[model samples]
Target: MGSDNSTLSSDVITLNHGVQQYFIPSCEKNRKIKIIATPNPSKGLVNINFENWDDIELSLSVFDALGKLILNTKLNTRNTQLNLSDLSSGIYIISIDNHCGGASSFKLILNSN
Candidate 1:
């Protein structure tokens, strides 16, 4: 629930562009959180790194281009590698949410060959 006075904005940028954006709640504007998913053009295996802030639980979710959720799980560690061998080769979106705070998303690719 955002107020009409909230002028905050969220933008999606390409990974190569070197600019990253996250969805910040109006109340947590002063906090810093970073979510990184590596090996973007990966071969079915990828690693997601949650940087800064730890010892807390978080969630990672994967969705297909059709906006359908494929996988969702809670992460107890700061870093975790996801195996998508069961999924077909395609493009998908991975979203990370620090249940206690912020959230962000990034694109991912899976190649079966």
Candidate 2:
């Protein structure tokens, strides 16, 4: 898995953001992965959806305003969902990482009743 086979695969191309490197894992080359949040402004509860993937290992987490992980879990398939009704009212960041090679970060704002 450590070998560089990208040069041999016509469909594989390297992608990067500034100084960060992005690549599709060798094990999940044919799969797709995505993450999303609903009700940008969340109140007692929230629904997070991780969509589209043939085979992936995903992680979803909620962080407090200070960037501390208060809730987290691992998901390994499509249409994964997360419930965030136990978190206290405040601004939180939701991070989804396909440990295989994809990741996305977003914010969730929680308000009091």
How close is every model to the real structure, measured as TM-score?
Answer: 0.71, 0.61
Which residue runs of candidate 2 sit more than 4 Å off their true CA positions?
1-32
Prediction 1 TM-score vs. true: 0.71
Model 1 poorest 10 in a row by lDDT:
18-27
- Misplaced by over 4 Å in model 1 are 1-29
Model 2 lDDT per residue over 1-113, tens place: 57543422223222222111122322366654444445557665554554455555667777899988788888765454455667777888777666555666666677755
User: Model 1 over residues 1-113: C-alpha lDDT tens digits?
Assistant: 95454234345432433323343222245655555566767888887665554556777899999999999999888678999978988999888777665677777878877
Instruction: Report how far residue 106 has shifted in candidate 2, in Å.
Output: 0.3
Leading candidate by TM-score: 1
lDDT of candidate 2 at residue 87, scale 0 to 100 = 70
The TM-score that candidate 2 achieves is: 0.61
Which residue pairs of candidate 2 clash? none
Report the Cα RMSD per candidate.
9.4, 11.7
